[model samples]
Target: MSAIAIDQPTYEVGARKWLITITVITCAIMELIDTSIVNVATRQIAGNLGATVEETAWVITAYAISNIIIIPLTGFLGDIFGRKNYFTASVLLFTIASFMCGFSGSIWMLIAWRFVQGIGGGALLATAQTVLVETFPPDELNKANGIFGAGIVMGPTLGPVLGGYLTDNYSWHWIFYVNIPIGIAAAILSWKYIKGTKTEMKGKIDYWGILALVVGIGSLQMVLEEGERKDWFSSLFIVIFSILAIGGICLFILRELKAKNPVVDLRVLRFRNVAVGSALRFAFGLSIYCSIFLYPVFVQGFLGWNATRTGLLILPSAFLTGMLMGVNGALIKKGISPKALLIFGFAMVIAYEYITYMLATPAAGEWDFFWPQLVRGLGFGFIFVPAASLTLAGLKGKDIGQASGLSNMLQLLGGSVGLALINTYVARRIVAHRVDLMGNLSIYNPESNERLQMLTTQLIEQGNSSQQAQQMAMSIMERSLSTQSSIIAYGEGFMMIGVICAVILPLVFMARIKKGEALDVGSAH
Candidate 1:
């Protein structure tokens, strides 16, 4: 165990601070990169591991489940151990897990290692943000946040590109191997420059809270990750886990409320800003994740694009988002109200979603996505910084950490929920659209009969018998109709998400806290 001390005087922006910041940010990028990096390689991994595509999806689901469960508790763990020690250990653990993940021969083994990787990866994300915030003084905090925000946006965007390139050129294992050198560099810098500020606590470990939390969050994540694939409540396993998840979460909330030293301080909801901010953050998470989730699927599934092409197409939008984050951060520092920025952000996102819905079609190409994706980047830029600054504006010391944890947890949960919901709706819409389109099918339908006859003639010209040509033409016609139906479903899905974002706009008025008020909650204990 590492020794603890009281919060020290604010550090100067010297070589030490800069070095530590780089280390923490690098680790953060590593963690975020893994979240989507493996997505492009999923097919390869499934083939190599002798697992079906559906079963191999556990590699992603397992990591996500562990990440959501561990993120809320990072603050408490950092407090229990020294921050530097905890962070260093997490990096080491994450690095080792990455290696194990790359080396696993079986799908289950890979999933287990990925879960362990998530335990370490979760700490890196929140802890890095807290560390960066603490390193800068109040005056320069927005600038610090902008830097951090860039990494947050960049990581996911770059993940697919890098993973796709590596998987196509070399092997999928290189995705994990690439983290090794970066991890080593971060660990060395952290050891040299990262300092610990400790707090005092006296109580038994909240084992019950931890148990309830893990059980609740883990079950909830499992349901979200697999719910669509399992046909929602139609599957017995999904139904059972859904019940456990809901029950466990309710019990966890009650336990946290009553516990003197709660694992997560549910009491922080008393602050109107924090509470409202968390809700917005959840919505933001939903929008961001769903958009990201949909983009790749649309491109690959509908357009027949390769992974590399799909990944590269997203890069410009992400860079634009990074640039916008900096601009928005500067605006916040200049005394602009966060509410205005947040409202504008939501409007921009809604517009972007509408654009996406309009542009979604079987014939849509990479160029068609560029403008809307750039708009998305700008919208996210407006949302992330101001929302976070406003939420924690009045919070001080430990509450900052707690608020951070809560906000991040909600974001994760929101992403999971949004993705699951969108996928479910997409599936339903496909069936409905298919039926609707099929209802009009008849020999008397002039356009349909002409199309079928044309296709039949082409098949017959290619040496098929008359009857076989007719059957082939019908099959092709059905496939074309199904494809159109899927495109329509995807469009509707995007539109629904836009409506959801629009609905969240009213809550911005409920936030009463002014900017610059110091929040009183201390660091996680």
Candidate 2:
């Protein structure tokens, strides 16, 4: 526990402060790292469980869906149950689910456990951010957020890297089993170090709002996760979930407006900074997640790099971003404008994405990514902390808790939507580009004729019969053409993300708060 005395000027500065900080950051990191860790091991999981690849993908979607549904509800649940007890229980739940995930007998069992794991993981994220915010005074808020931001940045990058190593050297189960020690430590630290007031539970639970929230958000997540697999509205499940999403959301709005106490509190968004902040967060999530998803797929699928190499390539970039967080904090503390930092951050994103766009080539190598990735890290350092702080700048008490939940939920939702769009776009664009490339392979095109003839001759020289050699040459040509088409499709994805970042650049001006003045929600306890 911390050593803050009664005579101390502020609870924000003490040994206990750092203890609580580490506890929350560790839990958040474990949650985040788990999010991407299973991705690289999907095939292994499918084979081990005797399931198809598509069935295994549900493991990913189930966790993601549960995360989105649970994030916004964390604050309300914490208020009802006591924040410290709730947080500690969530850690224990997450740890237990992780163990269950490792020992699952079938795909469905794994998916169910993964969903349960996400419920705990989701609460840890939002609650951790809220707890970290409460630990800092108003004047030093950005620096605290900066520390949190580093954990956020490292999680996704580390997930694939660490998962790759564990799966390659050991087995898929180690990825889940590895969480036991970290989870137990985090649970103990949270119980002892996290300090907060016990809620009064003054009014009746908003049962209607709670049901509506579950139906609305849950259905919406299903639509997003399974849309590509189910072909959007063409499938019956998508249609039903879409309708439920729409109807539930409408009922939820009406119910919250009339209720004396709301479960999620949509009313807090009436605050201007919160409104603007949510929009910015959506854009940030879209750009960041889409880029992260695209790069690994493109490099490993097209460039022929192994999963381990791909993860290693991304490590330096994430490290630079984590390192720059302190400098960003120091700058924010000195009264430099956060809006100015935001503008620069947006510029860096544009630069990173556009550079990535230009870097797309069949001949590009690992060294080509080093500088662009470093810039990417630096850009995020300037972005997430200020964006979060400015959003909750003027609010106090439960508003901060509610806003934090909303903020975290929006960002995760943004990642889901961004991933969905990227998948659709890449699928469509690949076909379009392939057709356009094939158009030039006509008999009249001398270059195409010459290349095919050269390949046929080489095959014949290697002792193949003439007819079989020509057929093989043509097959090889088709594959080469497809690979080029895929590269162009991925390049287009990067450019689309760049456009999203640019579109949000204008929102930087609308923010109402500045540096060093971010967190003023006094003594949430």
Look at candidate 1 and tell me the lDDT of residue 345: 87
Q: Would you list the C-alpha lDDT of every candidate in the order shown? A: 0.85, 0.84
Tens-place lDDT digits, model 2, residues 1-525:
011112222455788889989999989989998889999999999999999988999999999988988998887887767678989999999999999999998999999999999999998988888787778876667777788888888888888889889999999999999999999999988888786445555678788888898899888888988999988989999999999999998998898877878888888889888988888788777777787899999998988888789888888888887777777878877877778888888799889999998998988898888789888887887888777766877787667777878888998888888999988888889999999999767669999889999999999999999999999999999999999999999998998888888988898888787444545566442
Instruction: Report how far off residue 339 is in candidate 2 (Å).
Output: 1.2
Give the best candidate by TM-score.
1
Which stretches in model 1 have alpha-carbon errors above 4 Å? Answer: 1-5, 515-525
Give the per-residue lDDT of model 1 (tens digit) for 146-222: 77777877787788889989999999999999999888888878877787766665676788888999989999999
Runs off by more than 4 Å, candidate 2: 1-12, 514-518, 523-525
lDDT of 2 at 171: 95
Overall local distance difference test of candidate 2: 0.84
